[model samples]
Target: MTIAVRTFSQLNEAASAIASDRDAAFFGGGTLIMRGINEGHAHISAIVRTTDAEFRAIRTAGSNFEIGAGATMSDVLANRELSFLHEAARAVGGPAIRNMATVGGNLFARSPYGDFTAALLALDARVAAAGSSGGRETPLADLLRDRERNGHGVISHVSVPRPAGGAEMRFVKVSRVKPKGVSVITIAAYLPLSGSRVQGARIAYGAMAPTPVRVAAVEQALEGKTLDASGVAQALAVATDGTSPASDPIASEWYRREVAPVHLKRLLLGQPA
Candidate 1:
C-alpha cells in the first residue's frame, strides 16, 4: 500500500496528533520506514515527520545525559560528550545507516541484532516519553520489554547515567564480514575491579535468545573472582547455560551458542576461554 507522508514542525503535537489520526504514524529519519515499506513489513496510510522538531539535542540534565530520540547514530558517535555510545553506534550498519537510523527507532523496533540495546542495558539507560498520558520516565529495559506500553507518544529523550566506579565496559558483536550479516551474538560487559578481584560484573548478551538476556549466572561467576583462565571458563559455561537457540538462514544455533560464550570470555578476560 502507498503511504502518504506529512511533516510536522513540533514533536509532541505531531506524535499526539498521530495517536488520534487512526491512519497516521510518526516518521523519523525515514531510514527504517522506507526499508520496512520496501520489505512489505509496514503498511501504514500516512506518516507524521519529526524532522522539524527541536528534539535532537544531546545534553546533561541532572545526573544523566539526555539524548534526543531523534538523534542519529552518527550524531551520537560524533558527539565526544557521548563517548560511551560511540563504539556501539559505529558497530551499527554502515555509514549511510549510521547517518539515518535514529536511536528511538532502534530501541522501539527491538530488533535482536540492534547494538544499542546491549550498550544501553549496560549503561542503565532510562527513557522519557510524552503522550496522551502526559509524560514519564521508565527503565529502558522495562520499556523494551513492553513495546506497546507507550501510546503513540514520542520517546522525547533517553537518560544515561555517567559510568561509575571506574568500570571497564566492552561491547562485542560477531558477524560475518559486511553490511549484511546479522549478529551471531552480541555481548556487553561492565566490569568493576577492586585490586584484581572483580567487585562487580554485569554481562548482557543479545541475538542469542528471543530478546536480549542478561547472563546473571555468568555475572555471578565472574563477580568476586580474579580474571584468570579458570574463572573465564566458569564464566563462559555459566553464560551458555539454559539457552535454547534456533537455527536461521543467517546462522546455525550451534554456531551462535558456541561462539557467543567464547566471545564473551575473550571480551571480559582478554584471552581465550
Candidate 2:
C-alpha cells in the first residue's frame, strides 16, 4: 500500500510508518520497488509516496540549482537551466521510462543502472534530506562512501553547483543498446583546461565498480599536465588503477577494465572508438 503525503512534515510521519511495520520503504516513482514486489519481495509492506508540489519544483534561482528528489527524468532533460545534466538524463531509459523514473530513485539505484549518479559525482553535488532526526545536508560523495550509515533519512533534494562554462564535461554511456537499458560502462568526466594545460579534473566511472566511484588517481595525474599524447597516455594508464569491476553476464571484469580507459579518453580528449 502507498501512503500519500504532501509535505515534509507529513512525510516524516509517513517515514515513521515504516517502523511500525516490519517492512516498509519510501516510494520514489516505484520503478525498482514494484519490480522487487513482483519478484516476490513479500517483506515490503508499505510505501511512502511523495508527490508534493515542492518535490516537483525545478529550482534554479542562482548559479546553483537544486533538483527535487521527486523530479522526473523528463523534467531534468527539458530544463535548459540544467543543460549540464541533460545529456546524462537523456542517456537513461527510453521516453516512457524517463517520464516515470524519479530523480531520487535514480540516486538510490543498486548497480549498472546509476549513470545519473556518475554525472552527479563529477559535478560534486550535495544531497538534502529529512527524517525523524530532522533535515540535514550531505555531500553526494559522502553518501556514496557511507550509504548504509548515512541513508537512514529520506532524500528531499540534491544541490548541484553548475560546472564552469569553459570546463569540458562529457557523459559516455556504453550499453548493449543506445539511449536505453543498463550501461556496461558509464563515464562522466569534467576537465577544466587552461589552454593546452590541464587545470583540474573530476572523473566518475559507473557500472565499472560496486558503486559509481570517482577515480582520484586519474584526476591527480591529469591536473597541471600538458594535454599532449604523453600526458593523456599517462593519465589513461592509471585511470582504472584501483577499480574492481564485478564479473557478470553483461560484461567481464577484464572487458570493463580494457574499455573503461577507452571511454574515459574518448569523453575527455574526444578520441573516437
Candidate 3:
C-alpha cells in the first residue's frame, strides 16, 4: 500500500491532521514510525510532519530547560547548554541514528530504546503536546503510563528543571555492544543533597519494566541518607522490588533483574560498570 505524507508549517494544523486521521502517524525523526511502515505495518497509511521552527527549538527559561519535540539527538549533543544530557543523548545511537532520532520520538520508543526518556524521567520532566482539545502539559510519567490513549497528539516540547544547588544528574546505559547497541538496561538518577544526605531523590530505569520507571521503594530507602556504603547498600536491597523486566534477545528478564541493583549501586557511587 502507498503511504501519503503531509507536512505543515503550523502546529495546530499538524495536530488537526493527526486528530482527524486515526491511521495517520506523526513523523518526528521517522526512526520509529518509518520502521513500522517499512515492516509492512498497514495500520499507518499516512504520515504527518511539521516544519514549524518551534518544533526544533531548544532554549532555557529561568531554571527550566526545554527541548522541542523535533530536536534530534545530534541537536542535543551540539548544545553546550545541554551538556548534562550529552551522555544520555550519545547513548541513543551512533552518528547516523542520532542524526535522525528526535527527542519527542524517543518518548514513544519501546523498551530498551527510550534511554533518553529514562533520563528525562529522572529529571522530573514534563511533556507538552497539541491535540484536538488544544495544547497541554503533562508529567512525563503520566504520559508514559497512558501512552497509547494519550500520546496520539502532536508533541510540541519537553522541559525539565535544571538540577538545583547540591544536586547532580547521572545516566548510564548497559548494552552488550560498545558505543551503540540496544540497551540491556539503562539507569538515570537525580540526587538532591542536603550536606551529603540524599533528599528528594529521583531514580529511573529503562528496560526494567514495560516502561521506564522510578523506584519509589529504593528512593525512599535512600532519602535523607548519606551516599555512603550503607546508603548505597540500602538502595540496592530494594532496587528490583517493583521491577518486572522483560526477556528479549538483548538480555533475559532474569539477567536484567540480577544486574539492575549492581548497575544502580555503581551509578550512585560514580564507579565504572
Candidate 4:
C-alpha cells in the first residue's frame, strides 16, 4: 500500500491531521517511523510533517530552556547554551544520525535508544503537546507513561529549567560498543547540594525498565546525605529497586542489574567508568 505524506506549516493543522487519521503518524526525523515502514510494521498508512518555524526553534529565557520538538540532535549540539546536554545529545548516534534525529522522536524511542529522554527526565522537563482536543503541558514522565495512547498528538516543544545554583548534574551512558551504540544502561542524576548535604535529588535511568524511570528508593535513601562513600553505599543498596530491566541482544537483565550500581556509584563520586 502507498503511504500518504501530509505537510503543514501550522502545528494545530498537523495535530488535527494526525488525530483525525487513525493510521497516520507524525514524522519527526523519521528515525523510528522509517525503520518501522521498512521492516513492514504496517499500522501507519499516512505521515504528517510540519514546517512551522516555531517547531524548529530553540529559545531560552533567563536560565530556562524551551526546545522545539523538531529541534534535531545536531541543533542541540550547535547551541553553546545547551553545552551541558552536549554529551547526551552526542550519544544519540554519529553526526549523520544526529542531523536527522529530532528531540520529539527520541521521546518515543524504545528501550536502549531513549538515552536523551533519560537526561531530560533528570532535568525535570515538561512537554507541550497539541491534539484535536487542544494543547496542554505535561511532565515528561507522565507523557512517557502514556506515549502509546497519546502518540498521535503533535509535540510543540519541551521546557526545562536549569539546575539551580549549588546543584550538579551528571549523565553516563554505558554501551557495549564505543563512541555510538545503544545503551546497556544510561544514568542521569541531578543533585542539589546545601553545603555538603544533598537535598532533593532526581535520578533517572534508561534501559533499566520498559521505559526510562526514576529510582525513588535510591533517591529517598540519599536525601540529606553527603556524596561521601557512606551515602553512595546506601544508594547502591537500593539501586535496583523499582527497576525491571530486560534481557536483549545488547545485554542481559542480570548484567544490566549488576552494573547499574557500579555506574551510579561512578556518577555520584564523579569518577570515570
> What local lDDT does model 3 show for residue 11?
72
User: What C-alpha lDDT values do all the predictions have?
Assistant: 0.75, 0.78, 0.89, 0.89
Show model 4 residue runs off by greater than 4 Å.
Answer: 131-135, 150-152
Prediction 3 global C-alpha lDDT? 0.89
| Candidate 3 residue lDDT tens string, 1-273 | 878999999877988988888888889999888788778764777899999998899999788998998999999999998988999999998999999999999998989789999999999999888653434678999988888674458778898898887899999999999989899999999999999899999999999988888889889999999887787888999989898899999999999999998999889998987
Q: In model 2, where is the ten-residue run with the lowest total lDDT?
A: 1-10
lDDT of 2 by residue, 96-191 (tens): 888888888888786788888899999988888756244466889888777755345677788888888678788889987654757888999888
Candidate 4, residue 25: Cα displacement in angstroms equals 0.6
lDDT of 4 by residue, 1-273 (tens): 799999998987998898789888899999889989999985788999998988889999577798999999999999998877888898898888999999999998989789889999989998988652444668999988888775537788888897798998889999988988889999989999999998999999999988889889989989999998887799999999999999999999999999999999999989997
Report backbone clashes per prediction: 0, 0, 0, 0
Instruction: Kindly indicate the candidate among 2 and 4 with the higher lDDT.
Output: 4
Clashing residue pairs, candidate 3?
none
Global Cα lDDT for candidate 1 = 0.75
Q: Poorest 10 consecutive residues of model 4 by lDDT? A: 129-138
